[model samples]
Target: MRSLILVTASCSLLAACGNPAEEADDPIVAETPVAPTNAVDGMAGTYEVVMADGTVVSQTLRADGTYSDVAEGEVVETGSWRADGSRLCYDPEGDEPEQCFAGGQIAADGSFQTRDDQGNVVSTVRRIGDENMTTEPTA
Candidate 1:
């Protein structure tokens, strides 16, 4: 019958427009690169960061291209650091990849700020002390 053929065609069209296997349920997010700012030389020092959840993290950025992160006086992570122009790059141990931050700014009050790949201020650093001195001070 003509009416049965029309309904069948409409059902076929609706099925064709339904969820495709190639389409993902969640949208893919792209990270936007931020413009580099401030040099990494002056940032070589110990910093204490208060995270969004009030978690305090201590980080030491050495001048010899190394860094260490301590939590509650215990070393949690150690890695190497470098400067990709004005951006600060950190390469962690094992299979973990490197992360580079842009728009780095160090304030006179010892506070610092860096932007994520999306140009958002996701990290705040405050200098707590000078670089570690390996040599024993002569009394």
Candidate 2:
């Protein structure tokens, strides 16, 4: 009958529409790799700190959170360091105040710049050796 054919056609159309919930049940999602959020991971190494005045200081950032600066083969400063988000902060072992610098991510060539509060570059730290190289050999 005409009514039976119409009902069959309507059922076919409804079935072809499919269920939204079923379609979303097994979606093919793409996974993206996450980058490191802490800048300290790449910061523990020996670097040459090139100041704005063209003075170069050899600095070492240890994995134990301590740091030391050498100028003309002498240790001029010692400090403790920490990373706050993408910023690197240093607390010197004296009357000196703590200093924090932005732009802590090192580039592919193992160099990164430190920016002051006014977004001016204060120094460029370039990695020259691994952190282990600064450590004394154990017996």
Estimate every model's Cα lDDT from 0 to 1.
0.49, 0.54
The TM-scores of all predictions, comma-separated, are 0.60, 0.64
Candidate 2: residue 20 lDDT (0-100): 39
What tens-digit string does per-residue lDDT give for candidate 2 at 4-104?
A: 11111122122222333454565542233334445455456666667767677766777677877767776767777776554566777877777666654
* Candidate number with greatest lDDT: 2
lDDT of 1 by residue, 1-139 (tens): 1111111112212222223332334344123323324434444566665544455666666767677666666666667766655456677766677776653433444355555567655555555655663211233
Per-residue lDDT for 107 in model 2?
51
Q: Which regions in candidate 2 have their CA more than 4 angstroms from the true location?
A: 1-39, 104-108, 135-139
Best by TM-score: 2
| Model 1: worst 10 consecutive residues (lDDT sum) | 1-10
lDDT of 1 at 23: 31
Q: Positional deviation of 1 in candidate 2, in angstroms? A: 96
